[model samples]
Target chain A: MIVDIHHLNFAYRDSEILKKIDFTVKPGELLAILGPNGVGKTTLLKCLNGMHRASAGTVMVEGVDILKMRPMEIATKIGYVSQKNEKARLTLFDAVLMGRKPHIRWRPSDRDLKIVEATIRHLHLQEMSLRFIDQLSGGELQKVCIARALVQEPKLLLLDEPTSALDLKNQVEIMLLLRHVVDYHHIGAIMTMHDLNKAMRYADSVLMLKDGKVFSHLHPSLVTEQMIESVYGLPVEIHNINGHPMIVPKDSTQNLCC
Target chain B: MHLHDGQIPEEYRKYIGRKFVFLLLLCVSLLIALLFSISSGAAHISLTDVVSSLIGLETSKKIEIIVWNIRLPQAISAMVAGAGLALSGAVMQSILRNPLGSPFTLGIAHAAAFGAALGVMVLGGGIMTSNSMGAVQITNPYLTTVAAFFFSIATAAVIVAIARMRGTTPEVMVLTGVALGSFFTAATMLLQFFANDVQLAAMVFWTFGDTARASWSELAVMSIVVTITGIYFFCNSWNYNAIDAGEETAKGLGVRVERVRAVGMLLASVLTATIIGFLGIIGFAGLVVPHIVRRIIGSDNRFLLPGSFIGGALMLLTSDTVARLILAPHVLPVSVLTAFIGAPVFLILILRGGRK
Candidate 1:
């Protein structure tokens, strides 16, 4: 297992956001966290990466408990890509090189620059590496952000709504890239997602969150229509197309004209 | 395009090399400005004479005295104070994540002004003069400077404390700073209302912010503070760059966002307070220079911080020299010149879309 999270609890003052969340991710696995808004999906990802301190429980990456590690140490073990990134007037090359912050003290070594260069080329961003981040398109920016995370050389990756803002074509491209990254890098990835069909199609495992608690953690093939309806509080129909499960709202076709 | 053994591309190398060239050009420009400022004063000393005087070559005694005692101190003070203020402004903008963040906008300058007024009025630091102009002399410069530093840091502390309690979002910090600025300005006015003519004149004069007010010892102190603070900002340039990306992203990248923000505010505040205490409230340089530098060098703090330092020194030195020689034998306040040039340029930058 790449990550073993058990009995995780988080709270903001008196109100608890995550309660006794338990899950594990194996190497080369893609776990998609699915839920409606305000269900603590983002919060759970934050806890796993030590961005937020868990009130209780252990997040064991490999063997050591990451909760006890400093933020720099945890960053070396897990890379995180936020949902919203500001458009900064920085070159794509420099922005990707910043992922070496945890490992660099005064300046980036030759090895660090080499890693950044390789990561950018690997993600096909060499052509625009000199361009400013603020001038990049949405899909290109998202890819650059992902490239930044990949250069961290982490054992696990966490992304909060990685494709929540992209068009359909860009979304598929990002998902395919992420899938390839997990397989090629042999690293585990956990990302919060809103699109059920995309999650079902790409995720090796789906973890549904409702009311700040885990509703179900199972393979996408094992997730039933009843589970989706119960977690989302909306009627959904499951359809299998080309061996991939597709989720559609029950009345989705009836409102096509509207 | 493929990396065989982790080699950086030549194109990227050239791109990075260009920013370094820009930095080198700024340094060269600052040197020229410094020489011009030293050469052009009320005294008609030539640039060759100024260079000779600086190198301790056999120059005229009178020229040496004028260059070393008067123009050199004032010119160096302008450079040091401008560098300090601009560095502070750059860090302030980065940590607060606001384009408008600066010592003047965040009320640290106003707080220092109020503290100086209080020092003159209530701290027995002002001496009543018999001149018809009613010019009041600061009998104790240390008392006034200490007072100004105290109030300025107090204002920063309040802002940082509020940010700590209510979250270090840019909106919260900037709003709090604006509120404190208004409060301090009002308090200064209230003190002036009850002051005698001499005290009122002294208080009013202090707010004009002339770099010529500093002597050699004071210049030494300002240089030390600027050097120390500049080094601190440079060392933490990566942290500032991370914060520029956004607070959550910084935290995820192993940056302690809150700590960096609080400490950065305190240090930048100290830098601003030191300059304001010595030279009064030199407006616009702190607020406008960083924006101008960002437009030229981009927002990489590693380059931006040093770039602002050199850019600021050049701007202030050139402005001070022009203000000194514009009317020749009668010096306009450096703050007035900066505001006159900074305001129009700032407006143009805004209209041109300030950051690239």
Candidate 2:
């Protein structure tokens, strides 16, 4: 297992955000965290990456508890892509080069530059390597951010709502790219996603959260429409479309036009 | 645009190289401004004479005295002070993530002014002269400087403490700084109101921010402070770059964002206080020069910090020279000229949307 969480709990002052969350991710597995807005999906990812301290329980990544590690140590073990990527005047090359921050002191070495270059090319970001980040399209910027995380060479990767803002084509492109990266790099990835069909299509396992508790943790093929309706408080129909299970609102009219 | 077998691309190399060239140009411009400033004073010393004296050549004693004792210290003061203020401004803007962030905007300058007023008014540092002009002078420069440094640092401490308690968000810091700046300004006005004519004159004089007030020893102190603080800033340039990306992103990259913001602000405050303590609030260089440099070199602090430093030195030296020559034998305060130049340029930047 690349990551193991047991009875994880998080709170902010008076309100508990994540309660007794438990899950494990194996190497080369992609886990999609699905939940409604404000269900602590983002907070759970933050806790796993050591950005937010968990109130209770252990997040064991390869047998080491991340809660006990410093941010720098955890950064070497897990890469994180934030939900909101800020637009700055920095070049794509330098922005991705910043992922080597935890490993290098004072100046980036030749090896670090090589790794950044390889990652950029691997993500097909070489064409815009010199372009400023503020000038890039949303999909290109998202790819640049993913390329940055990949250069960290982490054993685990965490992304918060990685595709919540992209269009359909970009969303599928990002999900496919992520799927390839997780499989090819032999790394564990846990991403918080709102698109249930995308999760069903690409995720090896899905962890659904509701009311600060886990509703279900199972393979996407095993997720039932009843469980989705119970968690989302809306009736949904699970349809197998193109050999993948997709969720559709049960209230939609089946035949509309003449 | 393919990478050459995992090698860094040549286009990226050229991009980095272009920023370096811009920085080098700034340095060259600073040197030219320095020589021009030294050569254009009332003594009619030529650039050749200035260069000769600078290199220890056989210049005349009178020319040497004027250059070494008068022009050189004032010019160097402008250089070091300008560099320090601009460095502080660059760090402030990066850490606070606000283009309006600077020591002057954040209340450190006003705090120093109030401290100087206190020293002149209550600390027995002001001399009340009975001459026809009713001249007032700071009889004890050390006392005033120490007081100024103390108050400026006290203000910084308060801001940092508030950041620690509340959080190091840009809105919190900037708002607290604006509130404190108004409070300090009001307090200084109150002090000026109760002061006698000599003390009032001395307090007002100290606020004008004349570079000519700094002697050789004072210039040396400013140089040491600026050098040490500027080096500290450059060492953490990458951290500033991360913070510019976003606090959460910086944290994910293993940067202690809160600690960096607090420390960067405190150090930048110290840099500002030291310069203001000696030179007396040279405005707009801290606030405007960083924006100017950012426009030319982009927001990479690795280049922006040094670029601002050199650009600031050039600006102040040139301003001081113009201030001197505009009214020969009677030097205008450099702060006035900095505002005159900085305000219009800043407006243009704002109108242009502050694009790089």
Candidate 3:
């Protein structure tokens, strides 16, 4: 398993955010965490990457408990991309090179530069490598963020709403890029997504969070309309189109929970 | 998304040539400023005379006293204070992510002033008459410096504490700093209200920030402190660059975000404290020089730090020379000329709206 979480619990002050969450991910698999706005999806992602401490559980990345590890130690093994994109003033090359901080000694080695160059090329950002990041568009900046994470060369990748700021075409392109990189690099990826259809199409498995608990954790093929409706508190129908699950929300008032 | 398919600038690719050229230019400019400052003083010493004296060629007795005893210490003190303040300003701006973040804006200057007042009251042997600048001469310079250093660090601690509680956002940090600065200013004013004439005169003179008071011994101590702190800042240049991207991103890149910020504040505070403790409050060097350097060379701290150091030295040395020569035989406070230049630049920064 590339990532293993057991009986994980988290709270902010007195109110609990995540409760008894348990899951495991294998290498080369893409796991999409799906939930409503306040269901603790982003918070859960923060916990797995050690940005937030788990209240009562353990997160193991590559068979080592992350709770016992320092932030720098966890960062070496798990690359994380945040939800909000900043207009960084660094050149794209330096921005990506920043990811090599954990590996750098006094200065960047030739090997480190080579890795950053390769990662930038892999992201198809060679043309803009010397440009300032603030000059890039939202989609380009998102790619830069991902490129920075990729340069870390982690065993597991965590992304929070990676496609939130993108348009539809950019969204699909980014998801495809993530899938391609995860497959080629053979690294496990866990991303929180708001688009249910995209998750159903691209993720190897789906984890649904509802009211700070796991509503359903299973393959996308096994997801049912009742499960979706139960978690979202809205009526929805699932249709199989070209071997992919697509959710269509039902228009009804009486079935809504009181 | 690229606007041009033009080849990346060769210098950009290598990361050595342009930066080297810029640094070289800054060094050359500093040397010119040093020579200009040393030669253009009231004594009317020729460049040859100044050069000979600097190289220990045994000039006349009057030339030696003017160049070695008075001018050299003042000129070098200006350079050291400029470099230290500008470097600290750049570091503070980066760590706080605020363009307005500097020793003055962060309350460190006012805090140091208050401490100086405390020092004057204690070391000047109580209520002093305002008639004489030398009447309240501090019995122990170290006492005043230590007091100033303590208060400056204390101010930084308060700002950091406020940041920690309210979140280390740029707005929060800047607001807390402004508030703390105002409070310290008010506190210093209260001290001045209660001060005797001599102590009041001493307090006022200390705040004028003249480089003439820097003796060789004091310069030696200031040099050691600046060197140690400057090297530490240079070594962590990459980490600072990472943090500039954003805190979460820096943490994701394996930087200890909170720890780095705290240490950065500590180092920057110490640098500002040591300089201000010796030279009094030299405002705007830290604030203005870094901004100018950032506009010219860009915001990469690796280049920005050295660039600010040299640029700052040049500005202060030039400004001090102007202050000395603008009126012969009597020197205006260096801070007067600095603020004359700095206030306008600060207003321009606000009007231009370039800073993020």
Candidate 4:
């Protein structure tokens, strides 16, 4: 197991965000987490990245407890891409170059530059590299962010709503790029998304959460409509499209009405 | 859109040329400062007289007194305060990650003002009746200056501590500084009110800032402090670059976020403290010079810090020269002159920058 979570529980202030969340991921696999908003989707990713200190649980990555590792150590191992779409002061090259941050001190090294350049090349971000990050369209910025994380050269990649800011085509491209990262780089990925159909289409496995508890952990075939309906608190219709499950609205107007 | 091209051709060229221009500008400003500091003062000393007096030529005692006792030290103080404030402003902006961050924002200047008020009112009155600004110790001049420095430093330290404990939000940090500044200003006001007639005059005069005290001894300490700090900050300001990338990015880059931030603020604040104690609160030089430099130099602390220092020193000298000769025998306080010039210029810069 690349990551093993034993009874993870998390809270902020007086409210619990995650409860007894047990799951695991294998090496070089793409695991897409699906859940309603505010259901520990981002929180789970934070837990995996060691960004959040869990209230009660052990997260073991590669047979070592992630909690025991320092944040820099964890950062070196897992590159995390957050949802900060715009911090305009940073240029594209600098934003991407920041991925090398975990590998060096406050100053950038020659090696750091080489990695940043290579990552930029790999993502075909050579054109937008100098543009300020805020000036870029959402899709371009998302790609730039991914390139930044890729430059970290981490074995595990964590993304929170990587496609949330993107349009449909951009969403497809980001997913495809993520897929490339998993397959070509041999990096384990666990990303959270709200698009169930997209998740089913792209992810090798699925982790579903309902009210902070793990609803189920399964492959695309086993992630039943009933399971999603229960977790999402609404009636969801699932249809098979070329062997992948596409979830749809029971009532198009309201959020998955039960 | 891409990373391969790196800095655009213009920025790369700018990165090099700006440094040269900065150096050239620094030299020109220094010469300008030296010329005006020597030429323009209360006494009608000829340029030749100022030069002769400076190089130990046989000049009259009047020329000698104006140059050596009056204008020379004042010039040195202006140079030191300007450079010190600007450099600290650059550091503060970087550390705070806000464009508006400055030494004045942190309450160090206000604290220093209050300390000077105290020193002039309590210490000077109780000891030196014929005392004046920069009038060294019949008692401990250094002690009085240091007391001012430490009071400001302590206030800054408290602000830093509170901000760090509360998660270092920009809003919280800035608001904290604002609150401290108010507290210090109120205290200074209270001191000014309670002071005796002679003491009141001294306190009021000091608040207006006469750099007449920038004696060779004070300049000696200023150089030492400024040099040590300049070198130390030139080395450490890269952490500003890292943190400016974003706090988490800085942390990922192995910058202990809390430690670096606290250290940066403290260093900048301490420099402000030391400077204002000797120079007596030269206002707006710190705030304006750094802001202008940022427009040309960009926000990278490596570039911004040193650039602002030179820019600031130049501004101070020029302003002081104008203040001195503009009023002839009645010398206007340096702070009033800086406010007059700097405020308008800063307003215009901000207005133009806002358009962008």
Candidate 5:
């Protein structure tokens, strides 16, 4: 397993954030986390990378316990893309090149430079490589951030709302790009997403959380209409649109008969 | 193991080459400025005599004394102090992620002033006597500098403590710095209020920031400190570049953010404290030179650090030269000229609104 979390729990002081979460993902697999607001989606991602220490249980990545690893050590094995999308004062090329920090010696070697250039090319950000990040649109900035994460060459990738700021076309492109990266690099990607239909369509597996508890953890094909309604506290219908499952909200005006 | 030799894109190659040319120009200009400052002092030393003296060739005794004893040391001191201040300013701005974050803006200058005032009123036995312009000769210059260093570092400690308690948010740090500055300014005012005429004269002169005050010994100290610290800042250039992104992003890039911030702030404060201790309060070389250099060289700290140093030295040398020549013989303080020059340029930069 690329990531193996068993009975993981996290808390902020006295308030529990994640409760007994257990999940395992292999390389080249995309695991999409679905949850309502304030349901510990982001907290779980932080725990996997040891940004927030787990209160109980173990998180093992590549058969090594993450709690024992140094931040620099973990950084080489896992790349995390945060949701805060503020542009830094850096050219796009330099920003992506920064991802190689963990692997760099005193200075960047020829190999490091080649890897960065390759990643930027792969992302098709060559046009804006010299432009400052502040000049880029939201979609372009998101892609740069992803490219930076990709250049880390980690075994696992974690993304927090990667597509939230994107338009429809950009969102689809980003998802496809991520999927392609996972397949080509043979790395596991776990991302927290708000869009249920997108998650169902793109993710190999889905983990749904409700009020800091695991509501369901299953393959996308195994998720049912009842599971969505119970976890989200809303009535919804799941229709198979082509080969993908599409979620449609039921009529709110329909009253439940006593 | 050669990997993709010459794979660097044409644009990036051009970027590196342009930065190199820019750096070269700054170096040439700095050299020219130093030569000009050395040659144009109160004594009538021609450029030929200056060059002859510089190269250790034969020159008249009086010419040698003016160039070597008086003007060369003063110009070198100005360059060293300016480089130190500008380097500190660039590092602070990058680490704090605030454009206005500099030694002057962060209360280090005010603290140094207060310390110098304390040295004048208390340690130096309140100067000799008050003259017509309230200018009195200080009894002990070394004590004044030591006291200034002590207080500036103390102020930095307080600010760092506050940051530790309240998080290193740019808003918190800037506000705390302003508050500390006001506190130190008020403390200096209190000292001035109770001081005698001689003490007041000494205190006033201490704050005027004259480059002529830098003796050969003080210049030596400043040069050594600046060179060592400057090299240290250069070596950590990539770490600083990572920090410019954001704290969390820096951490994700495996930078120890808290450690880097604390150490960077301490070194910056030390640089500020040492220079301001010797030179008194030469403002805006720290504040303005780094911004101008950033506008020219882009925000990469690797280039920004050295660029700011050269640019800052050039600015201070020019301003000091103007201070010496504009009034001629009755020279004004270099700080006055830097303020006159730096304030308007800073205002224009702000009004133009191209600043990152």
Candidate 6:
């Protein structure tokens, strides 16, 4: 396993955000966490990256305990791409180059630059490399962020709602990029996403999160209609399309709730 | 999408070249400003005589007093305050991730001012005059400046800590700083009310920022501090670039986010305190200089940081020169002139930012 979260419990102030959760991802596998809003998906990702410590359990990357390791050391092992806030205003290259910071001290070497350049190239971002992120479209920026993560050369990668504001084309592109990252880079990826269809299509494994704990952790093929209904808190219909699961609401309400 | 490619300019690619040039330029400019400032005061001393006095070749007692004893200190003080205040503001702006971050806006300057008032008005604050300029040896004005600066920094630290612990928004940072600054200003005013006539007058003028009383000895001490810190800060310029690059990105890159911000703030606060100790509360140098520099050199602190220092030194000197020469023998306080220049420009930024 590349990442191991054992009996995890996390809270913000007085309110508990995560509880007694056990999750793990094997090397080279793409694990997609599917859930409704406020279900602790992002929190779970933070735990794996050592951004937030688990109150009751432990998060281990590869064989090293995240709690015991220095944040810098953990950061080098598990690269995380997060939701971009307003403060980020640097150009794509400058932004991606920052990903090499964990490896180099005081200054970046020629080798670091080569690695960053290769990561950007691997994502086919040569055209948009010089552009500031804010100036780029959501899709382009998402790729830039992924490129930055890849520069870290980590065994594991974590992402939170990487396609939240993207258009349909972008949403598909980002998911495909993640799929490629897992297969080509042989990196273990754990992504939390709202789109069930996108998750089922790209994810080798799916983890259903409900009320701060993992409702189910299984292959995408094993998530039946009954399990989807139980986790989402609503009756949902499931369809198989080209060896992938398609989850939709039976209520024709258009928006699915879980 | 990228139009040109994100590759850094080859000139800036090697940190050594850009930073080295900036350091050399800042030193050269400081030297030139020092020379220009000595010659062009309210006094009618020729440029040639000013140079002669600076080199210690002049023997005329009156000319020596004018150049060495008076204008030289004033010039050096203005340079120190300009470089120190602007550098401090840039570092704070980068750390806090707010363009409006500065000692003046955050009320660090006011806290320093209040501490000065308290030292003078509340605790034997009057100048002891035996030498000219009513030498303030007994009062230890440096203590007041240092204390005020620290108080101001403490306030900022508390606010940042609270913001971090509570996960505060930018509006909260602004509101908190304003409230703290206003409270400190009011307290200083109350201190003034209880002060004796002479103490009150001294406190009032010092808070208003007059470099008229600057002496060579004081400026030398301040320059040493500014010089050391300036070199240290410019050395870590890339660390700042990493932070603004994005917090998660910085974190992923192994940049210690919390530690970086804390260390940056401490260094910036020290610069503020050093300037406040000697130059008094020179209004808006911190607030406006970086903003202006940002426009000229874009937002790369690698360039923007040192650029602001150079621009600030030139700017404050220009403003001080105008204040001195504009009225001849009847010189106006530099604080008022800085306000005159700073206010309208600050208003323009507000208007422009609003329009955009």
**DockQ of each candidate's interface versus the true one?**
0.59, 0.51, 0.38, 0.23, 0.41, 0.32
Candidate 1, which segments miss by more than 4 Å at Cα?
Answer: A252-258, B1-5, B128-136, B348-356
**Which regions of candidate 6 fall more than 4 Å away from where they truly are?**
A13-16, A87-89, A241-244, A252-258, B1-31, B43-68, B127-147, B160-174, B194-197, B227-232, B342-356
Better of 4 and 5 by lDDT: 5
Local distance difference test values of all predictions, in order: 0.89, 0.89, 0.84, 0.77, 0.85, 0.75
- The candidate with the higher TM-score, 3 or 4, is 3
Residue-wise C-alpha lDDT for candidate 6, range A57-138, written one tens digit per residue: 7887777888788877887888888886443445677677777767777777777776766677778876776666667877
Q: In candidate 5, how many Å is residue B166 off?
A: 2.8
Q: Mind giving the per-residue lDDT tens digits that candidate 2 earns over A217-255?
A: 999999998998888877889988789887998755343
Best by DockQ: 1
Model 2 agreement with the true structure over B59-119: per-residue lDDT tens digits:
9999999999889999999888888899999999999999899997899999999999999
Question: What tens-digit string does per-residue lDDT give for candidate 3 at B1-356?
Answer: 11122333453556646777998999998887887788887668898998999999989999999888888899999999899999999998988878787998888998999888888886653344443433234446667777888999998888778778876666776787788889989988998899888778778877888787689999998888889988998988888887788878887777877777878887899999999988778888999898888766678888899898888888888888898888767778898899787778767865775664
Candidate 5 lDDT tens digits, B1-356 = 11233256778768878988998998999888888888886666777888889999998889888888888888888888888999999999988888888987899999999999999887864566555644455667889999999999998888888888887666777788899999999999999999987788788888988787788888888888888889889888888887787666666667777777777888889988889888889988998899988876678887899999888888898899889899876788899999898888877876776555
Which is the leading candidate under TM-score?
A: 1
- Give fnat, all candidates: 0.67, 0.60, 0.42, 0.07, 0.30, 0.25
Worst 10 residues of 5 chain A by lDDT: A249-258
Candidate 6 chain B: minimum summed lDDT over ten consecutive residues — where? B1-10
Candidate 4 Cα misplacement greater than 4 A, ranges: A1-22, A55-66, A85-90, A105-107, A241-244, A252-258, B1-73, B122-144, B228-232, B354-356
**Model 2: residues >4 Å from true position, as ranges?**
A252-258, B1-5, B128-136, B346-356
Residue-pair clashes per prediction, in order, are: 0, 0, 5, 9, 0, 7
- Name the DockQ score for candidate 6: 0.32
Worst lDDT run of 10 residues, candidate 3 chain B, spans B1-10
Q: Rank the candidates by TM-score, best first.
A: 1, 2, 5, 3, 6, 4
Candidate 6: fraction of native contacts reproduced: 0.25
TM-score of each: 0.96, 0.95, 0.92, 0.84, 0.93, 0.86
Count of clashing pairs, candidate 4: 9
